[model samples]
Target: MQPQFQSMQTTGSIAVGQNRVLRNTYLMLAVSMVPTLIGALVGIQMRFSFFAGSPLVSFLVFMGVAWGFMWGIEKNKNSGLGVALLLGFTFFMGLMLSRVLQVALGFSNGGSIIAMAAGGTAATFFVLSSIAATTKRDFSGMSSFLTVGAIVLLLAIVANIFLQIPGLYLAISAGIALLSAAWMLYDIQNIVRGGETNYVSASLSVYLNLYNLFVSLINLLMALTGQRE
Candidate 1:
């Protein structure tokens, strides 16, 4: 009876720890968005264009920088520097995002389309996150499949840089949106199940998921409903 009681205590403690981590992760995720919004506004005002001359070269450079930031953040995940690095990375991403927003704003109904995409993304996040929090099923098993899908999507994106196929671009956007939603579910469940204990790392994972989902949704919405001025 003592042994069983001890086991129950341990489980309860772990659940508390996981809940704390999830709470902190959510707080950090919300805070990180402030820098992202600032960066996007600044970029839009400056007419920032990442792919200035060569799309392929600019993309390669961007990927290198992004990975470097991720590496730094992971290496310092236990320290305050991790949070700083994560914010910086999000700012960079927001700057990149401004290009899309600029293009979207070029359409006659661009603002409405952007709003619709944002609403849809928020709805998707709410549903997936709620399921992750309440459902007892393990989603960690989906990691390997999701990783393969991400690799395939990355390869397709690189190919499209040269192919410049509009249809394939839209298809890839749809694929990314689906994958992002799946990843968010998997990631949030990891937090709920205590598989991921570090709030900093967890927030970064979820933030990336949200960013990708938003971008992909915008792309699809603009394609389907955008009206040129």
Candidate 2:
């Protein structure tokens, strides 16, 4: 009876710890959005572009810089520096997003299209997150499949840049949006199940998922319904 009681206590403690981590993760995720918005506003004003001449070069440079930031964030995940680096990364992402946002804004109904994309992304996140939190389903099995899908999506995107194929670009955007939604579900479940313990890392994972989802959704909307000015 004593052993069983002790086991119960241990489990209870673990549950509390996981709950704390998950709560902090959510808080950090919310806070990170501020920097993203600020960066986007500034980027729009500056009209920043990573490259003016070479699309392939711009893509490669952006990937290198992004991976470097991710590595630094991972190395510092347990410290305050991780939070700083994560916010910085999001800022960079927002600046990157300006390119798409600028193009979207060129449409006659650009504002409406952007708002619709944002609303759709929020709805997707809320639904997936609620399901992960309330249901007993384990999404661990999705990790490998999502990873493979992401890799394929990345390759398709890079190829499309060079091929300049409109059809493939739209298809890749749709694929990315679906994969991002799946990733968000998987990530939230991981946090709920205590599979991920670090809030910094968790925030980064979830933020990337949402960022990708938003970007992809905007691309799809532009392709499907954007009205040319």
Candidate 3:
């Protein structure tokens, strides 16, 4: 009887811990958005360009820098430094987004399109998160599949950079949007099920999911509906 009671207590403690992590993650995710917004606004005004001469080189450099930041954030996830690094990474991502935003804004209804993309992305996140939180279904099986899909998508994106095929570009954008949504669900479920115990890492995962979702949605929308200026 005493052993059973101890097991119950252990389970209860884990539940409480998971709840705290989830709450903190949501708070940090919200706070992270402010810096991203600021970065995007400044990026648009300044017309930031990573490298004007070579798109492929710029992309490779950007990926290297992004990976470096992710490694730093993971290494410092237990400290305050992790939060700072995460915010800095989001700011850099916003700056990276400016080029796409600039392109979207070149259309006659660019603002509307951007708003729609944001709204759609938010809807996707809210729906997926809700399902993950409320449902008892385990999404653990998706982890491996999604990881493979992401790798393939990344390779496709890199290839299209040189191929410059419009059809493939559209397909890649759609694939990213789908994968981002799935990842949001998986990440949230992982948090809820005590699979992920760290708020910092969880917040980073969710933020990246939302970031990719927004970017992909915007690309799809602009490609299909954008009215050129």
Q: Please report the candidate that would top lDDT against the real structure.
A: 1
Mind giving the per-residue lDDT tens digits that candidate 2 earns over 1-229? 9999999999999999889989999899899999888888888899976666699889899999999999999999999999999999999988888888888999998899889989998999889989999998788999899989999998997898889999998899899899999999999999998999999999999999999889989999998999998
> Per-residue alpha-carbon lDDT of model 3 for 1-229, expressed as tens digits?
9999999999999999999999999999999999898888889999987757687999899999999999999999999999999999999998988888988999999999899999998899889989999998999999999999999999998898899999999999999999999999999999999999999999999999999999999999999999987
Q: Which scores greater on lDDT, model 2 or model 3?
A: 3
Query: Model-by-model lDDT, in order?
Result: 0.95, 0.91, 0.94
Which order, best to worst by lDDT?
A: 1, 3, 2
Residue 163, candidate 1: alpha-carbon lDDT: 99
Per-residue lDDT for 48-116 in model 1, tens only?
A: 999988999999999999999999999999999999999999999889989999999999999998898
Distance from true location, Cα of 188 in model 2, Å: 0.7
Model 2: lDDT equals 0.91
| Candidate 3, superposed: residue stretches over 4 Å from native | none
lDDT of 1 at 158: 98
- The candidate with the higher TM-score, 1 or 3, is 1
User: Where is model 2 more than 4 Å wrong at Cα?
Assistant: none
TM-score per prediction, in order, is 0.98, 0.97, 0.97
